[model samples]
Target: MSFINFNFEPSLQEGLDAMGFDRPTPIQEMAIPVIMQGKDLIACAQTGTGKTAAFVLPILNKISKSGSNKLNTLILAPTRELAIQIDQQIQGFSYFLGVSSVPIYGGGDGIVWEQQKKALETGAEIVVATPGRLIALLAGGKMDLSTLEHLVLDEADRMMDMGFSDDILKIVNYLPQKRQTVLFSATMPPKIRQFSMKFLHNPEEISLSIGKTAEGVTQSMYSVYDGQKEELVRHILSQKAYESVIIFASTKDKVKALYKVLRKEFDIEAFHSDLEQLEREKIMSNFKNKAVKILIGTDIISRGIDVVGIELIINYDTPSDPEDYVHRVGRTARADKEGEAITFVNPKDQHKFVRIESLIGMEITRNPMPEGFERGPEYLGEKAKSSGFSSGGDGKSKNKKKKKPGNKPAGEKRNSESGFKPRADFKNAPPAHKQEAPKQEAKKTEPSDTPKSETPSKYGQRKNVIDS
Candidate 1:
């Protein structure tokens, strides 16, 4: 269906036209009207399914009609990357309209914090934030959400995975009990369902293509030993068939290692939480502007980052979560364009890869190892005990075992910070800096003995607002 059929505010229709958005995807087609009616909604749709517009467009139209200057909407995202992405889209979608929004996330300088404070005080109409940063701001007594009318939780499942449940419930205390709530996530696990029930009052539900990848994406896998993995990556990049590529590594250390090796050969950059916030923004802009062709990062970039025309995605390491495998590959094959996703699986990860295949309901084609490379260890699915941060036996929590650094050949040493081993003869290599202390991987569930949050739940009972 075309967006024009919705008959949105003429100003909003103008913004849609400027965005080249003529037709609505299934999610948008089903979700936009419900949200326009100010009904609470829970939508399950995969990444790259145009879910952002499904909510953003309707909200902009409503805000435009009411013409209120006070903050009217609050959106909480799982990561700073997603928060920034959403803020940018809001800017584009509300171009013809007068809606304004400010992105609130950590890893920014004091000046940015003050600017956000000003936006909040001056009535920016919309606020997009990360849970932790928003909570921090709330504690500082600088912002108010008492007038917020719409609440959106994008990637709600990921928000829970990042241990933001209590943070979210805390944020709810500042909101009006009668506000409209909208949640959109890629997967609908039991936990997500419970979360929706806690906040939404008989929300209308919509699910489309859940746990399935876009048809335009061609998925494949290569089995290689740990040692030959680098060689395999080099071989693929040598083909030069893809113009833009994103490599997903398992950790920040792995991302740095891949970036160091690939930087000299291709225009590549690395992204992780450790980098300064402005540096990350510059890197993403460079990647989007085609100044950088290959971008490598961790699962943090796996969802809600929109870079158009990306032709290839290389998974340097398999994700333990089957759903994550979906998000990583979904980065490409977007906007109905054909793209390719390749996953590298070693002996220990074969079991996890199999689970991904099961979730997608299809076996990814196995590419034969290139000639002249040594054969990798056999895939011993059940017998292979995963080591070093492999998810639990069921693939849920992080492995608690301390990791030992891998051994290297004499004279070729790995930098503990970047995990990159330079050739002994490279004289111009940058000196490695000390690695920052690792942030808490994921917050444990609230301790039972801890005092209950001083913030009280305003909505002790849900009033169904879905018009029959």
Candidate 2:
């Protein structure tokens, strides 16, 4: 049915029409009616399911009916990016309804603080904020929520993951007790169920696609050595079908490094917590507009980003948490469009693969690396060699060196300088910078001990003695 069939205000309908959204998503269709009736709700839906609109629409409807635009709603989100995104969507849907909205989050200039203070002073219709900043403002007496008629915990699971349960409780203390509460999440862990019980009053549960990946996403994995991951990613990008890829790395440092590498080798950008707010916004906007071909990101982008037409998602490294894997791959295949998710799995991360397999309840088909792509492990070895560093047994620096046989001599030693006996290994060990020298000295000192006849060591001979 059309959005008009939901009987939204003409102004809201006009805004929806302008945005080309004619019909409600399944979650919205099922949730909006129940929410408009002022029932508490616990909604389980994947990202890109238009779940935001489900709650926002009914909240706006309630505000319109009450004719109150004075701090009547508070939507708490887990991240600055998500807070801003939800604020933007609220503005979009309520453009003609005169709903004043402000996003209060950290990292923006003091200007956000000023804007937030001013909005609260002048009675904003809705306030969307990250829990920390909003709670701080409320505690500092900069904002009041006593008139709040609705409370929304957007991305509730993420909030719980972010350790915001205490903050949520603190914020809820200021909210009116008889108000509607809505909790939305991509997955429903037991903690989330507990959280709902604590906050919601016999909430109506709405679940769409529970314990499943988005149907539109085509999931696959490439089995390659760690050394080939980067080249394999590049080769995948070279394919005509691969456009606007979001590559997920496991760490912030990797995100920055990968972004730098991709920027040098191809047209790409990176998003992570380390970026300045403006830089992050710029990268997100450019990527959204198709000005950038690739985005190297960490889990920061996994929860809130809603860019459309993302052709593929590349897991540059396997996600440590299976839920993060779900969110990362969910970035693509949005709005009913078919998309692809390719994960790069090296042998070192087999346990992680098993965890993901168990979580998703499906095998990630192993595909061969693209032809001409070099393996990552071998490439790192060659790189180390080229840089005059030896790739030791563990593929790290050889200069670090292993312990010599007689460094401790089976006894501890006393340090006269400190008047205390140190461990024999410590007493005989060279200084940090002299570690390499000991290796050469040990080689020379041990040559005579080498058994030319391949005789066993004393421990091996002792085994025969014991047996006799």
Candidate 3:
């Protein structure tokens, strides 16, 4: 049905018209009515499913009906990015309603707090914040929530994952005991269910496409050796179809490395916890403007970033956690646009791929490696030996002999002929046993460096380049 069917205020309708949102998403269609009836809600939907609007619309309606300009609503989000995003949505929906909303989170100047204090002083209607910063402000006697009429936990599972349960409970304790409570999560793990039971009062439960990837996204995986992931990533970027892409890696180092490699050919940016607040904002702004064509980041950018027109998401490294795979892919195919999610599956990470497929209830099609894309020797078989460096396995590397305590003496041993040498004390130490020849060591090379000297250069020169 059309948004007009929802009977929203003219102001909100105008804002929707401006945003070109003609209708409600499934979650919104099911949730807005129940929420408008003032019932608590527990919603389960994947990211990019209009979950934010589900609650924001109803909250705006309630505020408009009551016309109580006091601090009537509190929305707690897991990250600063999410907090800001929800706040922006609230502002968008309440654009003409004269409902004041403030977003409070870390990394911004205390200027936000000053604005929050002023808004509270002048009767702000909604306050969106990260739990930690919100609770701190409340405890410091700078903010009051006694008159709070509604409470919303956005991305509840992510909050728990980020260790905000205690802060959430504390924040709840500070709010009025009888306020309307709502919880939304991409996935409802047992912990989320437990939290919902503790907080919500006879909540209306809505599950839309539970544990599934967004329908608009085209999901696929590539089977490549672990060593050749960089090569595959480069090949994918070489295609002109992807206007903007976000590549997710499992670790900060990997994010930086991928960003460095991609930046050589395209405008690329990196986002991770290590970046300062200003730097992160700058990078995000650049990415949204398409000044940066590729963004290599950790899971931080997966959930809350609401940038539109992202054409593809590349999982340079398959997420070890199955839930993260969903979030990473969710970055694309947002709203109604079609998007593609390509994952690089090394042989050893097949189990993780299986777990993701099982959770999402769909097999990610395995396509042949792109032409000229080299699969490393390690990925030749169905299952490769664990790399041991990060995979936590002891194979050939662990089987190597350990030097005996007395095998080599403490001081330098002068040889009879040579000036200095390793003492040949093993003569009587043990029998001369046949040992397998040592495996050839893979060259110690940076990911940004050319795997082969003749590989075409994305950068001007064919010189060795180190990953950041």
TM of each candidate vs. truth: 0.82, 0.79, 0.79
Which residue ranges in model 2 land beyond 4 Å of their true spot? 373-468
**Full-model lDDT for every candidate:** 0.78, 0.72, 0.73
Candidate 2, residues 1-468, lDDT tens digits: the string is: 888877877766877898899878999999999998889999998788999999998888777667775778889999887887897788777766766777777764555456556656766778888898887798888877777888999999999998999999988888889999999999899999987798789999998876567888889886555555655565566555344789999898888777655553466677776656766777787888877767888899998898989988999888878888889988998899889999886545555666777777787776754433332332231123234323322322221112343434323311232122222221122234533444332121111110122444222211111111
lDDT winner between candidates 1 and 2: 1
Local accuracy of candidate 1 as per-residue lDDT tens digits, 1-468: 789999899988988897788999999999999998889999999889899999998998888888787889999999888987998788788877767777777765566566667657766788899999899999999887888899999999999999999999999988899999999999999999987898899899999988999999999888765666775776677666456889999999989887777665556778887776656778888888877777899998998689888999999889999999999999998888889999988766888887888789898898876644455545554445444424322222222112335644433332433233333332222223423444445333211111122454222221101100
lDDT tens readout by residue for model 3, 155-195:
99889999999999898888898889999999988878987
lDDT of model 1, residue 127: 84
lDDT value for model 2: 0.72
Q: State the TM-score for model 2.
A: 0.79
Counted clashes in each candidate structure: 0, 6, 0
| Decreasing TM-score order of the candidates | 1, 3, 2
| Top candidate by TM-score | 1
For model 3, the run of ten residues with the poorest summed lDDT: 459-468
Runs in model 1 deviating more than 4 A are 380-468
